[model samples]
Target chain A: MPTQANSSEPPELGLSGRKIIYDEDGKPCRSCNTLLDFKFVTGKLTGAEGTKPLSAQAPAECLEKLGTGTVTSAAIGESSSKAYPKEDPPDVNQLGRASWTLLHSVAAKYPNSPSDTQKQEMKQFMTIFSHVYPCGWCAKDFEKFIKHNSPKVDSKEDLGRWICTAHNEVNEKLGKEKFDCDLWKKRWVDGWD
Target chain B: MPTQANSSEPPELGLSGRKIIYDEDGKPCRSCNTLLDFKFVTGKLTGAEGTKPLSAQAPAECLEKLGTGTVTSAAIGESSSKAYPKEDPPDVNQLGRASWTLLHSVAAKYPNSPSDTQKQEMKQFMTIFSHVYPCGWCAKDFEKFIKHNSPKVDSKEDLGRWICTAHNEVNEKLGKEKFDCDLWKKRWVDGWD
Candidate 1:
């Protein structure tokens, strides 16, 4: 059983009152929620209102709410029970999904017969995206992925297929289902038929 | 009254069967939904289920579901009254929001005192982002914005502030509230207290 923290008082407004999981350098860990869950089976979770323990399963509706990124900022605090009505910052998974959507959408719109300049720019974009992506470990993984499989910018279709394959690689690593590359056009460019 | 297309048979599975607003070159117009709505004011809409006309209002629950990117792809097709159970591709607004979230989150995590290489990479990232953002008009506007106010990537804080201001500019154009720049750390780096 996880240690239960007393939750009687209304929590303070900011991170000052929260029990943040920190790294060796005292910086708050980006994956604090996962880390905290792994270390202890705490019944009460922080940063999300009505978050259940890791062992306890939440109903589909609750999970849907959480997945939709509707949880308030106050609920995300360290052990706070109050649900302030402010949008919470997205976590790594949310960020990743969003980033992938943007990237794939952009690729879908790439000019079919792109100029040399366009191709060069797309390559640069991927390189920079790998560098600036917020998740440190994920960025490193992308960088390595790029090194092994350079971007194919010959045409719009090429770029779209390349991105889809790259996305599938990430999905495979995460144990998620791989999207059919053949449906790339249908999914992004042409819409499903 | 808007011209009503006969809703006799179930539409084809692809975008071709849908009445997508297209440019002269047969490319799907970026503002198809808006264009379609302007041309027709019928309660029944296509391409994005539950998407209201610009003048109409959606209830909070519908808006929340839209914000959460929950509408299925089937909801986006022509005359599809049945709501499919699977996750759908994100619409333009949802895609934009998600993209912004990733960009802002990455900017928030930038190194405060970035090295020259980091600075160069960040600058490059902005340039490429402006060029390749999926929305055509949005990309053009971003390009202009970049030309007017070059990206400031000297430090992490500088980048965060710059991005926040840029985001606010977009918000201003969209008639949305501007986020407080002072709360950058609280919103992105640290959990709110």
Candidate 2:
């Protein structure tokens, strides 16, 4: 069947009496759940809220940015070896990667010598972006990041480097490898000649 | 040698007087050039401005958004066999694809129902976004799009569909497939059941 152009149906909880994820109002938090859990919902293998899948035999922190405490452990013998479904909508990680691509591209093409008005526009864009990003915790962290770094819109190179450092901070939190910020131009504007 | 934490060096034109890409002010237009050209500058195989490579043995419209008219042909007998270098900084197409991913995900995670304040914030974000998108021509087109469609921030579903339609317009212009807007929820918010 052809998918309709529009539907008002709420997303399926996919919970058969299992509270996998939600906020205070019992709404599934899209920004908090990994596609791994969303897949579990589809397969009817959902655990209760604060439930996080363990990739190894160690305890894991639940997706807790929008929830409560992230315990340093997982249930023993849970055999945490599920592959995430890619066809599903983005999870937190996917969203962040895509947003970084766009955000960095913005800085990449920024004028080398921007007018005052252009500089102000970039600053304003960052302020409003923090509000509209779907991840509440991520946005709050960005608010603090902006307070400290601000948007260095004086030039394209400056803005790109600033944004890259900001991304490195997020990488630190996620345990991802840090990109070489010195290569910001190579990554976003000029090729690594 | 370690990549610098910072450098004020201008991007290498990679030109041996070939005038491959530049605006009127003799500056490289980051948003105007493709990674392919950037690579060429690295290899120094540049043509004049408005030059676009042929992917097949056929005439092609030069990338003319930030330039003048696109001629309907490649130079005769030029082999169109070059593959875009993956590690180069993003070109216009790569930037567009990434931006679409982030923009769509925002709608996906949006609250199913939102407050007026949230709605205003979303609308403002879009407004500012069109201005700050690095591609000037693309941004102008988006400005026209927003003026015509406005933003449907009243509901997540509404915004998703609206943004999907907007993306379809871009897809159409790029001669790419128009994604089924009906499957938007499946693509952006939920995995297929």
Clash numbers, per candidate: 10, 3
True contact recovery of candidate 2: 0.80
Give per-residue CA lDDT, model 1, range B36-114, as digits (tens).
Answer: 3212322333554433322224443343344333333344343244322333345546667778888788877788789
Interface RMSD list for the candidates: 1.7, 2.2
lDDT scores of the candidates, listed in order: 0.61, 0.62
TM-scores of chain B alone in all candidate structures, in the order given: 0.66, 0.65
Q: Calculate DockQ per candidate and list them.
A: 0.49, 0.43
Off-target runs (Cα >4 Å) in candidate 1 are A1-24, A31-85, B1-26, B30-88
Identify the leading candidate in terms of TM-score.
1
lDDT, candidate 2, A1-193, per-residue tens: 1111124543343222223456566655655555544444434333443243333323223332312222112232211253223354556655776788889888976888999988988888888788777667788889899999888889998999999999999878765557777767766775444
Q: DockQ for candidate 1, please give it.
A: 0.49
* Deviation of model 1 at A190, angstroms: 2.0
